[model samples]
Target chain A: MDIRRLRYFVAVAEARSVGKAAERLRMAQPPLSVQIRKLESEIGAPLFRRGTRGMDLTEAGQALLARASEALALAADGIEAARAVAAGSRGRLSVGYMFVLANAMLPRLIPELRRSIPGVDLDFAELSASTREARLLDRSVTVALCMPAIHHPEIQVARIGAQPFMLAMPIRSPFARLGSVPMARLQGRPLIALPPPERDPSSSAVAALLRRHQIVMPIASRVETVHSAMSLVLAGEGFGILPACARLGAPRGIVFRPLRDATDSIDIAVCWRRDSHSPLIRTFLKCAEKAVAPL
Target chain B: MDIRRLRYFVAVAEARSVGKAAERLRMAQPPLSVQIRKLESEIGAPLFRRGTRGMDLTEAGQALLARASEALALAADGIEAARAVAAGSRGRLSVGYMFVLANAMLPRLIPELRRSIPGVDLDFAELSASTREARLLDRSVTVALCMPAIHHPEIQVARIGAQPFMLAMPIRSPFARLGSVPMARLQGRPLIALPPPERDPSSSAVAALLRRHQIVMPIASRVETVHSAMSLVLAGEGFGILPACARLGAPRGIVFRPLRDATDSIDIAVCWRRDSHSPLIRTFLKCAEKAVAPL
Candidate 1:
């Protein structure tokens, strides 16, 4: 039976009098009586017994009462879940970001996003600039945090934060004794860098900054992430240049010093497809903006 | 947005061409294109890039595509679930019965109900005859199997099976050595019976059978269930009279014998409110009929 008929039957069963049920349903008695009769006839059973005082349920009416309520509740829950999904206030949002962004950007952004849009389920994955871009294009991830601002026409990028360059040295290294490292301290010292300019624009920006200082340094090693570069520095392979935020949670063996002649900093941006219509993505971008505002 | 627009958008996104989507949907191309445009405008974003090759998703379109499909699916699941509930093919059916009926009636009936209805979740509760009747009247349980016939006008009773009274005795007792116990042999002997005739119709039927055989026995104790009666017999408190099905799974310490002079058998009926319109109740009744047919 349809929901309306079940509702009518429930009312009649509860009230026990056709007149009283009609009053509770805000309808006239005749139509309500007709509806109950129709329901009984459709099920091929008598639902009620008309007594001098009121009405009493037959056996079948009791069974319908239990099921009808559950069916109505299930239907209502489905509709509400669907509406929540369509509004982008619920369902899963997959996000990709760089490893370094976790400490600086994600700590603040994630909590705020959860508080504001509590219904959205969040999933995170660490990815390089190229992989993040590919995942965004293929719709595997809803948003990404990457470096040096993506310039694709279909990609939208919003500046999250910029951190000044810092010199990372092993605790026992000679440069660790100095409060700050000057650009001319060592003309050919080994320096650990990230991926090349073609794959990572942030690495390209760092290379340009060193050139502007006219400091020549031999490349010691190349790594894909700041965390790996830190590892290399800890092993005394070479000193490294990284964003200032990396110092917030660096291990005890690594010492961070300011680059005295550094004129440029690394830029991090929140990126998504420009055509993304999800309110969840829009909400996340707003949270990202708030997180980086003080940085 | 409504389900129809989301469906249209998913079609266009998947097919990558408005004309192809229209052909797949069995509709005209112009209206489909108009609907997509309307969807884009409503979301305040350009969902597709109109290239010479075909329509390609913009960033927003890709996001919408993921969520739209999930929302549509959720809505459809809700509708289907509700329809199943209304059809009585789904939802829970709580059944109450005495312990003895479990051995004879439940094993055969439960499997058939599951096979026939599939969607209805069957829940069984072992209750005393009085409790079963009370639970049925209060709607705590959907249907019940109990002894004798319920006399209530609002209750529907269907005869499921009849079991001749069997004498239960401890294996070490003298009565256990007899092929069948004569009614006069137990004169003045202690008897463990169910609730008195006033509280239980099954007990009343047993009392009437004893009277017809002219056998007078002193009541040692009264219990609410056949399991409890069997426990008393096992403890050597008294010999008990129980249904024939009780013999099927009786412990090794107890021996069941046919009453030599007993003519009346206990009548077990499946009972429910007569007005219950649930397909679950109807299905269970039919299954009950099949279960008791061989007996």
Candidate 2:
């Protein structure tokens, strides 16, 4: 049966009279009565009979009433759910972040999400230097928080915050007592460095920035993650260069200090697929800006 | 968004050109363009950014495209499912059968149901004499197969089959030698009979029928179900009156012989709530009429 006809049948059944149903529906009684007759013909059953008092339901009418109401209710709910998703007020959003930034970013970012799009469910993933760009493109993650923004033709990046590169060294070292180290004083220093990004060597731009300051550090050891760099520094193997946010939970024996003479800082950026127009991504992009604004 | 508008949008996205999409949709190009513009305006985002390529999707366009297609598909599927339910082709229908009839009825009835309405899920309930009427009224069972036809103002029953009353007794009884037992021989015999229905004792009308022939059965025991009566008769506790169909799967020690002078037989009835208009029930009612026609 057509949804409109079912609506008309329900109205007449509830009112028990076409005149009352027409008054509530704001239409003339004749058309409503005609629709009821049409529905009865469609189902090959008499839905109502004239009793001495008023309209009464036939057995077939009673059964149709229960299912018609259910069908109508389900249609309404389907529309409402679609609308909620289109409005970006309800849906699932997966956020990818470099493990190094999880503690610093999530603590503040989760609160921002709750305050804004509270109905959206959240999933979190840790993207290494290699996987962040691929996950965003493949839609494994809706948005990503990364440092020293990734460069790609199909990815869109927005700068939300920035933090200067810092020097992480053993607390007992003389450089820690210097409080703030000059970029020039780091010449010939043995360093634990993160390797170049898998597909692009450009993010190792930190090495280029250090070169501009006349500093050449031999690699003490190369690691895949910033956390490993901190560990090496804590073990007194070598000093390391890391984004300032890495200090959030650095080992107790490792102390982080500013590279006073270095002008370049790691960018805290949010990235998403260039072709995506998701309202959730748009809403999260705004939250990310606010979450790291003070940095 | 309206389902019609989503249909228009998906066409253009797949065709990648307004003129081509309009040709496929059998509409004029200008109106299609106007509709697309209206959709973009309603969303308050530009869906397309013109490039050397024809009709390229912007970020927002890509997102809306995915969800709009989903909404349209879900709406279509919901309508089809509702039509199937209304047509009695797909849904759940629970059948109630007396334990005694389970052997005689369901074996034949289930095959009929499978052939007629294969998409409908079925559930079976073994209703005792007490629960059949209540379960049907409450819709816990969609239809019930009962004996002697339950008589209630709110229930509708159809007689599909009937069987003569039979005498079940120890195989060594003298009556076993007779081709059939006479009604007069039952007079003053110790009997095992089913208890009266909870709210109505009229089904025990069997006792009243016996009185018409001058048979006064001294109650040897009163049991709750026909199966219980059969058990007592098998143990040689007393003779019991059962429907001829009860001979199916009877214990080895008992023998069933028909009444030669009896005018009454047990009626096999299919019953349902009077107000139900379920097509599944209607289909089952027809199947039941055929399954027991030979009986």
Candidate 3:
């Protein structure tokens, strides 16, 4: 049944007069009468009986009235539900994140996105730069927060901001005494903590930075989560490379030193499918733009 | 995009040879070639490069391959999920139960249904008989394991089995001495329990049974749950009416005796919507029949 017909029927039923129902519906009486008659014909049963007194109900009319009430309720609920989704108020959004942006932007971006779109459900999944590039092309995730590497024709990237890499070390170590850690100081270090060995650009970027200073030390340990690596560093275990955002979780026994030299600072970008048209994607993109505006 | 075409394209991509993919797909190579060409034409991009030794991916071919794989995966998952629901292997089934059935068939039927349909998700709700009747009419629950009542056109009921109503009293009560409780013995004895003022057929049936014997007494109390009513009986606080199936949880202090010259019996039925055509409805009806067969 057309939802409009049910709404008109409900209004007529409630008003008890066709003229009053049309007035309440803000439409012409003839159109309202025609819609009700159409509804009756489609259902093969009259919804209301007219008499000199007013509209009353036949046995069939009573049954239709009950059914019409339920059908109209469901229709109203369906329209509202559709509107909520179209307005980006309700739905699921799977986000792919790179380690650098995950630490730098996620804490603030996610909360802001939630406030901007109250009912947009969030599902977080970690994606290395390699997998994220592949995922964006395939539309596996609606949005990807990562750095732009080799650009693919099927993907679109929105540059958010950039941050320089920082060296994380034990507070009591001699490296902490330097105002800025020298590139040569990291040379031949017995060990360096690394992010998960998955093809994350952050890990590769750190390796490249080390390589630029002619430092080639075998990775001692690889950790999946940043918190675990931070905990180990705080225990005076080993030195590691991290972005400025990772510095937010600076443990009491750990110190961060700026890198003195680099070919270029890292840039973070939100990557999406070239054809993604979801309203939720636009809402999230807006929040991302606001998040990186000051940075 | 057609899911079948996507599957065929994936096979070609993985094999890198249309002839080999056709052989693996158990189809003629000519049709597979035509189908792939049609797909390329539809997408306005050539998805394969002609080579003498073996087929290789052009840039467009690689992009289409990724998108095709994703589409095929989602289509396959959606079909499997829908089929699982149809077969009662997954998805939720909300059930409503009467108070007496909750005490009797619940303990056995619940566990049996779970064992028989391991993946049949259940959302069992405690409901009064009147509420169960209304909800069944509204399609609020997929099924109602309840007693047969006044037939309504919108509701469908299938009789599972019947159990005789028995009288229960404390072991110390005078009526417990008799092997079977006689109608004359209950006269003017202050029958401590009866149905609440609501329109429950079980209570009405019991009341009709009493009126047939021309016996009436002040109701000492009215309780909703069978467990609570049984508690009152076991405490020597009142004489109560209970279904024979409720003997499963007979407390140590209580003794039950069948009523002689009484036509009171409880008939259990699986009630549902008369016009429910949902596949889940069909599968659950089958499971319920199998579960209640032992009774």
Q: Pick the candidate with the highest lDDT.
A: 2
The ten-residue window of minimal lDDT in model 1 chain A covers A74-83
- Clashing pairs for model 3 are none
What is the descending TM-score order? 2, 1, 3
Candidate with best TM-score = 2
State the DockQ of every prediction. Answer: 0.07, 0.06, 0.02
Candidate 3 chain B, poorest ten consecutive residues by summed lDDT: B74-83
Q: Where does model 1 exceed 4 Å of error? A: A1-65, A85-95, A138-140, A197-203, B1-295
lDDT of 2 at B86: 62
Deviation (Å) of B95 in candidate 1: 13
Give the higher-DockQ candidate: 2 or 3.
2
Docking class of 2: incorrect
What tier of docking accuracy does candidate 1 attain?
A: incorrect
Candidate 2: interface RMSD in Å?
Answer: 6.4
What are the per-model C-alpha RMSD values against the true structure?
9.2, 8.0, 15.7
> What are the models' TM-scores?
0.54, 0.58, 0.46
Candidate 3, residues B1-295: lDDT per residue as tens digits?
3446667878998999999999999999999999988866665556676769667664445545655565445433433443454444665677887766666666766776687667767788877754777887765776887754536778878777777778888888888888898888888765656454355534566677777888875677777656677888877667887777666677788888999887678677777787654455555566666665666
